[model samples]
Target: MATQAHRTKPALGEREMIVLMALLMSLQAFGIDAMLPALGQIAGEMGADGNDRQFVIGAYFLGAGAGALFPGAFADRYGRRPVLAVSLIAYIALSIACALATDYTMLLAFRLIQGFACAGLSVVPAAIVRDHVGGDRMARLMSLIMMIFLLVPILAPAVGQGILYLAGWRAIFGMMAVMGVLVGVWAWLRLPESLTEENRQDINLFPILRNMGTALTNRGAIGYVVGSALVFGSLFGFLNSSQQLIAETFDQGENFYLIFGGAVVGMVAANFTNSRIVERFGARRVGHAALLALIAISFAQLWSASQPQQPLYQFIILMSLSMASLGFIGANFSSIAMQPFYHIAGSASSAQTALRMSTGAVLGALIGSLYDGSAKPLAVSMLSCALVALAFVLFSERGKLFGRKVPSPD
Candidate 1:
């Protein structure tokens, strides 16, 4: 079992710590979303046929899922700082490789490596929070981190678009390479090693796998994780299709990214609200309610898409609402699932992140394959995934879906 230690002094100010953590975590999202604007350029350059272009994004998530499992154990064994340094350096190198890729296969390969390098950035900050805070405070801290994370989806595409206009798609990856290097240096200099020697676990695959097994065996944990994954899958389906949907359905070509950025505004607002409400309402209650809202909005989107007078504005409004609800669901579900596994937080986080990313990749792939120059596939997939997530949450909570006591982080 992992033991806790109280420090004589606070490590960092809450706002500064949360902001830095947010910057680290947001890199994963930036690497994925920021490139959306350049997908067409990349496709044309590499002769990518149809939806096969999505493999570029899907491969990153696949690598990230696989990558998340090892870093936590390494952090627990060596230290968070060292593991983070190595991961960031890998990310920098891979980003440069991605920028220089001459073919689709090479780009995809480097994206996978870049995704793997992001694992430490995503997992380590949360572990550091666990190393310091507990229970409701940890949940709040996570909510704060997520609020900052919410900014990536809001700004990354715009950044990518600006780069596209100035220098071209290649510059986006070049910028990412620079960002990785800077963040790595910042981490090496500023971030302390949160995992002390006494708290370190035996660094082995078997023990880590065993801890993952324990987390998987917990009904509530599994339900929350799976439910979160499905919800995330629904979002990923939309993300995978958004550029095409905007271009084809709305006849907005180069301006598609601008509209996508507009949709993310709703998500940022929702996350900011979630930061305030999560403590008072509890993660489960807020998550369950948000899932219901997501389902309803998705259904509305499906109905709207089925109509003859289906306007792009209608689709935009419904999608905005759906995305907004996602902000509420993401962090809450993760915190609820991780609450019970304080002793094995690293393995638990690895399992949950793996499940979420793998589910997103599969669902995104399915959505990408079904692209038919319309919004139907995207709407159908979103509604279906939302319904499935709602069902899982209902079953996981044994029909007590709202107002339940927040489980203490044990």
Candidate 2:
């Protein structure tokens, strides 16, 4: 069990800490979203064909998943600062390596390694937040963090495109390395340790493994992790195939970023609203409704896609609705998943995060590979994921659906 010796908040101011965590988490999103505009250029230069281009995104997520299981445990043993510092340095180095790649396979390899480093960014912040708070407050904090974290998606493609025009796609990667340095310096100088000395543990293989097993075996919390994976796989599928579908199927290549950003605005709004309402309505109640809404929106997307000469307006509107539903679902579901564990926060986070990423990455790559110059595949996959996710939710709730079963107090 985790020592709960330093459960009080850190020394950093709440606002500053929130913003810092926001940037740390957003770096991973920026890494993926910022490169969307350049996938075609990379493909053309390196002779990638068919759905092969999507491998660039797939490789990164796969590496992150594979590397995620270690960071949290390491942070628990060695302190968050050392683990985060090493990860940031690695992220900076790998970003440079990616920029220097000369072929498609080489670029994919670098991206895979870079993603490994970025896993620290994903696991540590959530663990750190969990170190101090839990339940609905954690959910509200996560919603705010997500509100800021998600801004990367809204603006990244445009930033990448601007760099692609002004300097080159490779320059976008250079910017990423520079940003990593800036964030690293900020963290090193200002961010105090969230895991205090008393809570630090010795590196023991058995305890670590046991804690991971405990977290993964939780009947209620672990169910949400699987459901979250399935739902997020749909989002990942959209990311993997987004550029191609937006540019080709919709005949909006030139306005790709604008249209994409506009749709993501719905997500931003939903998250902001979720932050306001989740504490009042409870996580499960709100998230379950949003999950159902996502399923409905996906069905509407299928119907829209089947119609001849469907207007881009219709498609974007339906997609925006789906994205909005995801906004409500993400924060609330994660909070519910994390609600059951406090003492094993780091190990639990590590195990669950690794599972979600690995499963989502594989499923997303498969969905992307099914692209055939149309939106049909994406719509079908999303609806299927939603249905499966709902089943997991039902299993988690013991066939119940709505109302909050609050975890025992921290």
Candidate 3:
């Protein structure tokens, strides 16, 4: 019954595609950020160790990392829309399962499954974007996606807290389920298959591994992935510890979302700025300058925390700037890493995300577990991660820090 134009890729214009892709990518952030306000409630209800609540987030990252490894290959073999559709269905089911979980262990297991199912959100969209565009245009488009994606974290905590006040924490998961279904249905109706038949790969382990190997051997891809992973440790560490840091260390439980969202606004602003300037300045120049600024801010924060008593405003200001720096760094790093692998875009995206999430989860867990009733742990963790990330970036650039490469031709 549908017209031919309605069934083709042109049905969704560039802006429509960007919104859909951004929504697909943002589901993971919604899942994690919106659950922060409920962590305390869930831990108390299940009689879990207070210090161990970060596992809920860590488990998701781990499962997402593991789950991401296969989706790229599958998407490349089948088609992006079909893979995304199946993943969203499983994501919806797992969200419901999480809401029904009766114990801490059960909840964690369901969260892990939810994350695994959500992995397609992280992997497929990048490949789809790469299929359509590359070079500075790719950087600009990815920055736009990142800009939209950052908005979720800004509002997610408030949304979670509001739900907590209304129907309780479990209803948060219910909301996630409903979100998944809506997005899934919309995508099924409108998303065209980006992977053409001739470009599709066979669904074989050997070929998948081979593609991964090729991706790994590319110095630009590997360096950027490792750098991004280490840099991401700072973000993961913050997420793991933020709920406690605000509620306990700062004794601002009542104003948690307001304070958290305020800092995230800095990131949103930076992302917007990056999207506008990346094409003219190049991703490398923007990312490297931001990385340097982040490192300096990290060290400054660490120094301030070493004083007899650091001001709360100082900590918030520094952290906001750090997050803003990440806004510039993340999309550029990912775009640069994937720049060298258009032919194997799906596999490359999967490998990059899996490595980044898995490594970040481990480092974040370590940093979070070291929370010692002060901001020292977080500041120190950010500084250490930034240092390592800088080294990786320099290595990847062969000691050069600000040169831009032309996007590989499709």
Candidate 4:
């Protein structure tokens, strides 16, 4: 395996790249968050139950995971810009189809494909960053991207709620389509190809399989990937059940976006803090500490959930704290996982994200399914995911915890 040292310098400025990457990647979150306020509207119109409603979100993740498994190899073979352009085109088309769907099944299918198209946004941006930098630099850049990316969750639900107030749920999809088109046009016009000709691989199956296998076998990479997936499961579980928890369980239907945005403040602060400190602390050290914090918070949330008629404020505080810890875990864990696979960044990113999205989606759907007019299921699943993530991190470290390894990208 060879590194990307011989490639021509990236054309885009760092700030420009960060803004572009954050915008493109936010599409996935926008798709999910913006629809949150309309889940009840979707359910009522579709004549579906609570469990079925969760699939509107889960299906997209499943498609994203499934679709993500291959595009990295394609990007490695072709180039980042072309693959991204094609995916954005597909994303726009599918989002439009989603808006026009007359039934639940059609909407679900369109969303799945839309998510599949959105996979390029997930893999390519990370690969592009890996292409330009490595080690702690990569971690810092990723954290910065995440710091900006966190704004989507903070604002998207509100946007979705506003859209719902002005129009129907279908118009939300229309808005997604418009955004996808605008992004596609911007990327086509300004985004330069990040992968160099020297690093380009042929679209051959054997090497793709071999490289993927090698990435999967790397102890550090796979460990962080799985750990991140478990942690993401907690976050996704919250997203899957949040609307009901806010609207019905807490009787705060009108205040859903405000409460949700308030919780996101903790995440925003954590991401900013991680961005400032990750280079000095190392991605693994910061992530490990955050994982511990998450476990502790999860236990506190679990205990609170066990009590009868838990105060909404108490629940919000614990949830906010958990998300705060998670903000550190997510981007750092991802940067660490991608560190060892610089040569195969595309394939590695695709595989890692595929696993993470699929696992989180499944775990979240399971937790959501267990919603029984209380928050116990969400608390139980979140605690379990956090503990499992900690276990994986410990195992990956082989008993060593806070030490930072010198990055070897050969």
lDDT of 3 by residue, 1-410 (tens): 02122133546898988888988888888889999888899889898786699888888988898888888998887778777887888888988898899999999998888787789899999999998888777888887888888889988899999999999999998998898888877787788777766677887888899998877778877887888888788789889888998899889887888878877777888888888998888889999999999999999999988878778788788888999999988888898988877878898888888888888888888888998878898999899988889998898899999996555464
Provide the clash count, candidate 3.
0
TM-score of 4: 0.96
**For model 3, what is the error of residue 11's alpha carbon versus the real structure, in angstroms, after optimal superposition?**
2.0
Model 1 Cα shift for residue 168 (angstroms): 1.5
lDDT of 4 by residue, 13-51 (tens): 889888889888988889999998899999999887866
Candidate 4 segments exceeding 4 Å error: 1-7, 405-410
Clashes of each: 0, 0, 0, 0
| 29-139 per-residue lDDT for model 2 (tens digits) | 888988988888888989999788899899999999888898989888876777788888888899899999998889999999888877989888988888877888788
Error of 1 at 351 (Å): 1.3
Computed on alpha carbons, the lDDT of every model, listed in order, comes to 0.79, 0.86, 0.85, 0.84
Clashes of 1: 0
Candidate 2 overall lDDT versus native: 0.86
lDDT of 1: 0.79
Residue 311, model 4: lDDT of 89
Check candidate 1 and list the clashing pairs.
Answer: none
> Which is the leading candidate under lDDT?
2
